[model samples]
Target: MLSLLDVFTPAAPVWSVDDLIRYSGSPPSTCYRYLKVLCGAGFLARVANGSYVLGPRILELDRTIRLCDPVYVAGTSIAQHLTDSLGYSTLLCILFSDSVMCVQQARSRDAPPQLFNRGQRRPLIAGASAKAILAHLPLHQLRSIYAKNRKDIASGGLGSDWEHFKRALKQIRSDGYCMTVGEYNPGVMSIATGLFNRDGEVLGSLAMVAWAENSDITAFRTLTPEVVRAGQEISARIAATENMMDLPARAIG
Candidate 1:
């Protein structure tokens, strides 16, 4: 039944009962019964044209998560502080399932239109924000991801083969951060470092972004330490808080 909600997305936010039935491959009677339960429970709402959209309960849940999730609370303050001090946009992104999702963003005055804004997910291949977390993932998980995306990994220039890919990520892991220019977003430079939990598991990445024209390549490298520091501070904050593991991050919308 919950799978029905997966059909609603930014590109197609409304679905009729007929559409749901066809998409779910469920009989009309089963679809109607599930929709009735979902609508009654406020997981979905019927529209004027008999289509349905996500209901207010989802908004309530989102609000609750932003307010109560330890990672979000800590990352929000850290992201805002970095943006204020660095004069660059700051993003806090998490590893949501296999994708990277931005959960918090603090934008500077000259910041470009965000390629992936808060609550939006992006692929795990091209950007510093994604690579920082990718480099820290457990090797078995990394191997699985690489096996599934060999072509994309090669296209992103990480490597053409699994061993090469592992070596590339190993280098980034040793460096403790990833820096990229115009790889994810044209004309933008991003430096990212991993955020970790109490158990030393990677939670996400903290990235600072600026226009390429505004930053000198050599000088930009200087800010890498600052971004790394912010990432560590956020990780420390997560560690200091009790029961953080119980509060798994809800980063995707």
Candidate 2:
């Protein structure tokens, strides 16, 4: 099943059983059975033209899981406050299992026309939010994430230079914030700080994104302290509610 999922990952949103079989290099009978089970389990849906796409069930499950995420539940007001204060778009994102998922977002009154709808999944190695989260991850886990998405990174969907990404993560770890320029979206600049839970475990990241022309890199650097403070404030709130201490020392690196 893991191999099958790996085979389908690149072809997601629009693929067929034949494509899956070809990618997996598996026999027709086995591939058909696997596809049938996946469809029956609501992992895939047959479109009007009989092509397979992701099903609503995956979304439904994703929603359910997100609802239970403490970071999503707690970060809404923080995001709103930050956006309101900074006049830039703010987003709350978490590493949802294997993918980084946006759970909440707030847009400033003068935010850009490009809408960042909730539930969007940006690349972990490219965008500020994902990079902030990735910065604190243990090295082995970071390697795994990079390996899993190597194809996309190599294809230029992520940053143009992989070495630059490595250097950026290192700087993020030292600086307590991550910044990006046109890494995720052209002409969009962003700064991000990672949020922690009661156990000091990285729960997610909070980010502010603005137009490249209007944002100054130095101004973005100045915003880092505020972003870190906000993240810590939110973390303390979660800790008070959960009544636990001693941050987990686990590192993805």
Q: Largest TM-score belongs to which candidate?
A: 1
Residue 159, candidate 1: Cα error in Å is 1.0
TM-score of structure candidate 2 = 0.70
| Model 1 ranges off by over 4 Å | 246-253
What range of 10 consecutive residues in model 1 has the weakest lDDT sum?
244-253
**lDDT string, candidate 2, 1-253, tens digits:** 4356543454366776677778768798887887788888888778887677766777888787566566766778887898888778888887655556787888876665664567666666667787788777766776776767777655543444557546656787788887777777788777888888765677778888888777777776677777788887777776766533335333333
TM-scores across all candidates?
0.93, 0.70
Q: Which pairs of residues clash in candidate 2, taking residues 3 or more apart in a chain or in different chains? A: 137-252, 137-253, 138-251, 138-252, 138-253, 139-252, 139-253, 199-247, 199-248
How far is 16's C-alpha from truth in model 2 (Å)?
3.5
Predicted candidate 1 versus true structure: per-residue lDDT over 1-253, tens digit per residue: 9999999999999998888999989889999999999999899999999999999989999998798666687889888988898788998988887889888889998886654688888888889999998888887788778888899999898999988999999999999999998898788889999888887888889998888776787787899999999999999999898756643333233
Model 2 stretches astray by more than 4 angstroms: 2-14, 96-101, 109-123, 139-171, 216-220, 241-253
